[model samples]
Target: MGWFGRKRDPQDANEMLRQYNEAEAARLAGLSSGSNLAPTTVSASFSSAEFAVEDVFTITGRGQVVTGTVASGVIRVGDRIVVLRDGADVGSSEITGIEMFRKKATEAAAGTLAGLLLRGRVDVARGDVIRTSASA
Candidate 1:
């Protein structure tokens, strides 16, 4: 049976699953082969990190928190960060904490969605770019 009481074809389901598996296998192979596909994580050799801010807010006792995906490189707790808006530097602060899905982490890499707790107040907002201070 299908949704709304319509009939479902068993062959169609099997074909769809087969196609999905094939695509997944290709994706995994690309990652393992280190093809031109964008990396899922930043390597240790990466020097600079960029995070695209999607949300920003202040935590009562912990200071400001910025949530976003790491666009490139890696970010770690205790690292100094600079905020950029429209390709211009806005302000700078220190990273006090990093978290993913409520789990504490010491660092996050490219393609990772994380929240960074800042050491002090900085003028940050949505659509800003956050990067390692050294890269500023």
Candidate 2:
């Protein structure tokens, strides 16, 4: 019966998969902890951050939430930002909250996709660009 092909040991395959899972978990933990990473400091005179809106919605008690990728710079809760469309100001809003992957984040850096809760009447739309005011 064993002449057709080499017999595979079930225990060995299970052990190899377990080892792979453990290694992957360790790698994820290191990435989450940001081991050996350097801290980045944005200047006080640095102009406001920027984001491109991908989705916009309103949370009952949380207000307007705009989810998008950070196009440039950094954004933090409480930063004032302007919503623009067609090179015109639609409105301005204060960031009330910021979140990434369902976890509250203090700051969202460039290239990160984050959801921002805005406090204002700024009507946000898909494709609109959000930018921090130069004087902010």
Candidate 1 clash figure, as a count: 0
Question: Residue-wise lDDT of candidate 1 within 21-127, one digit each (tens)?
Answer: 68856775676586776333322235678887889998898799999888788899988888888777899999999998779999998767789999889999888
Summarize candidate 2's per-residue lDDT along 7-50 as a digit string, tens digits.
86577866886798688557645755766642222223346688
Q: Model 2 has how many clashing residue pairs?
A: 0
Q: In the order shown, what is each candidate's alpha-carbon RMSD?
A: 8.1, 9.9
Error of 2 at 123 (Å): 0.8
Best by lDDT: 1
How many clashes (backbone N, Cα, C below 3 Å) per candidate?
Answer: 0, 0
Shift in Å, residue 15, candidate 1: 23
- Assess the local accuracy of residue 12 in candidate 1 as a C-alpha lDDT between 0 and 100: 85
